[model samples]
Target: MQPIFRVQSNLLYQRLEDALQQGLELRLVTQGDRFCGVPIALDEEFIEILYLHVSEDEDSPEEDPYARTVWVIRIAEILAVAYQQSWSRDKLAQLLPTDAATSEVEES
Candidate 1:
């Protein structure tokens, strides 16, 4: 997974909301070093996650290698969301186009 963006704790919900509205997939990593898949649902206290994993060996047709599952957790557990470096709003804002920068100023 590529490291793209890091959202501050205070901005986490707003960033997640924007991502959800844009139909973006986000991989959430916890402080415990666990990868808790894409967020499929969220609430004030918890978030529902969906993760996919594929087995390395293709030994038997009966043994399905692909697996998907959901995990739910409180917001306090999350540490970061994996994203492409270029897509990081906080990091890339200084490099934005003039018009976009203008819009940012307007928003502020």
Candidate 2:
């Protein structure tokens, strides 16, 4: 079956499309009180995010690269899908999260 992918924000959806077309990766950063990051992985229940963490000048080592932090977001928390794409079955199967509803449907 074809898989459905969705992004919640129009701006973020645009950025993701641009990044994919340009062969570039998006970096998630902190903006005032908000946090932004790319969606690296997802499952039926959670989305795994990888965001850059810059250490304070006082705490950062002279040559240290930025750190990456992984955050798990609940699928229910996602507002909507800003963009959708059809993915190969193999790829979709690998990335799609497994959940009780899905399991029940598959079993029946």
Model 1 steric clash total: 3
Worst 10 residues of 2 by lDDT: 26-35
The residue-by-residue lDDT of candidate 2 on 83-103, one tens digit each, is 335667567666767774477
Clashing residue pairs in candidate 1 are 4-83, 4-84, 4-85
Q: Which candidate wins on TM-score?
A: 1
Each candidate's number of clashing pairs is: 3, 3
| Deviation of model 1 at 95, angstroms | 10
Q: Which ten residues in a row have the lowest lDDT in candidate 1?
A: 1-10
Residue by residue across 2-26, what tens digits does model 1's lDDT show? 3233334558866666655655667
lDDT of 1: 0.68
lDDT for model 2 comes to: 0.54
